[model samples]
Target: MVEVERLFFMGASQSSSSNSNGEVVFKTETPVQFSPTLVSQLADRQNASPVPTSERQSTLDDQIRAKIKDEVGKLRREEEAVQKQIHTALEKENLDRERDGAGELADGTDSGIGAVKSSAALMGDLEEIRGKIERFQVRKSLQDWPQVRESREKLVECYRSHKASSLECWKEVEGFKDSVRTLEKEYFKTLQ
Candidate 1:
């Protein structure tokens, strides 16, 4: 007589037996309906190992760096676009002022207002013109522009250096964004 034990896996049975001679025999019985292709595929997958932690971390780091670079680039471009809009608005306002000043001067002179003006009044008029020019020259002040530009530059440099992750520069990036927002608000306020 033989003592036998059987184990089952995936619809297959494996058996081991000890015969009277004290020899061991092993037998495996696979289901007739089992597909060899499916078994081989599963076996291959089971045998394949997962990526090492260090390699996986490296890949994640690369992805994060790429994403950060993309975000920074997008922000920089947006900032540039806003700056251009601000410049365009300023130019248009300046041109309007010039045309209005020219028209006002022509109207005043043609209406004989300048012909009757006293020397003191002319001096006051000149002074007023100088004041207007000075105000126009420093219209928005741009006190925040340099700070925003510097912060953006710092963020870009940090990313390029690759010594630190994007998360580390997040505060600087946010600061730049805030500065730009403040500048934009100031610009719009001036327009108003």
Candidate 2:
């Protein structure tokens, strides 16, 4: 704890007097004291040792390179394992084909990947698919457009008859619109 006192100056009193030169003398009071307080945290950055920028960056780069090399090695090992599995599967398939008395591959090659086919076989498969499609495909019945044709003819006749007053063909135009709407409804029903 600390004690505090304030000082102030005023005109000279009876105890205080002006100097010989007739200048008014100023008087000072006791010193002012403040209460003790908590100290604040301070950062002494000047005393700290900092790592060099290039060194920090190089360390980060080395870590990244090591991680990449590890990942590459792992991927290469996985690829080799997959290759081995594929070769084993191919061997099993060849054994099966031999037991089934099958001759060479359809493409005439005995490679690792054995699914290549001749153009002739591909054409034969396409023809077979086409035959099946034709056999099972739904044949669209002919949509007789008699109503639409009649309405269209009527509209054309009305236009021709009233070339100067085409507004007189409004009934025929409405008839044609109704016919088209009906045709669209029937088309959608067939789709469903």
Candidate 3:
């Protein structure tokens, strides 16, 4: 360790040390030490990298998830298209049947409304059936769609049997009747 002082020269050390017309001088030297733990930590973090397999698996999973989402969207679209076609076909069928029938103005209330005697019990039954189908409907395909078809037929029969005597009311309730068919179809489709 060597220090230089401007206030003192060679062989000059006393209460007032000086040099040739010297003033004062200061010396400062600081030593730095590297701790072992700190050095190890720095070396350990030299190359920061994630585990390769985990990263690779995450990438693979992302790709799979994207593919599945795309496939599900396509499937949903296809189902909707097929359903629309089926509904259109059903509508055409009903229209053809009506056209071929006798000259009926579609007013069942006149005489086709039948006896309104047990109408209360029948209405109660219909209401119960309606309760079984609120917000969700069962769906099925042609091969094993007997139950959905049965429910649909029964609903239509109920509508026809209890059709409003007034044409105006009948027209309005016809919307609800259409919903029944829709529910049946939707239910059957969901079942598949």
Candidate 4:
């Protein structure tokens, strides 16, 4: 004879049985149902309000502006630190060269080749650091301009436009960036 049974589990259940044929069976099940009352309760929960597109765009713009400002400030700080390092190096090199000169004079053997080479190397390093600072200053100046901000905004709009392809906006973006680069180069050249 075959036996049949019915069981109801609220959440989850695991059952094992041995049939008359000596075969073992295991079954696991989870009983879940969405009740109308639960649905009504869920519907009653307050949802987060959505920000308007214009407000969101303005917020994004503000964030971008702040980020650019932060980046520029950081670059300026780094440039200042590099300048300080260069100055410190120059001072230390001068002091060392003075000590070497004094020692050589006392020894009656003055081979100033080493000192000259070191001074030349130090000058090269200082020049490189000055170039970096000049470039950074030029970039910061470019970023500070209102026209650059307007161009950026236009580029952003072009990218965001539904009818425009991103590729189409690349020219404007590259043009503005190239202009900034050119300005930096010209400014650096003037320094030289």
Q: Which candidate is the best by TM-score?
A: 1
Candidate 2, which segments miss by more than 4 Å at Cα?
A: 1-143
- In model 4, the Cα lDDT at residue 143 comes to 58
* Tens digits of lDDT, candidate 3, 1-192: 145554444425434444587875443354678999998888787646544578898998999999999999999999999999999999888667554542433464333433333436559878887977752344334435554456556656666776774444455456556756776778689679
Note the residue pairs that clash in candidate 1: none
The 0-to-1 C-alpha lDDT of every candidate, in the order given, reads 0.73, 0.73, 0.64, 0.73
Alpha carbon lDDT at 167, candidate 4: 83
Give Cα distance to truth, residue 34, candidate 3, Å. Answer: 36
Candidate 3 Cα RMSD after full superposition onto the native fold (Å): 24.3
Please give the range of 10 consecutive residues that has the lowest summed lDDT in model 4: 1-10
TM-score of 2: 0.28
Q: Model 4 over residues 1-192: C-alpha lDDT tens digits?
A: 122233433222347666899886766575768999988777665343354579888999999999999999999999999999999999998878766664354556875554434556669878999999999878876456666666777777888883546888877788678766766787699789
Backbone Cα, N, C clashes tallied per candidate: 0, 0, 8, 0
Ranked by lDDT, the better of candidates 3 and 4 is 4
TM-score for candidate 3, residues paired by index = 0.29
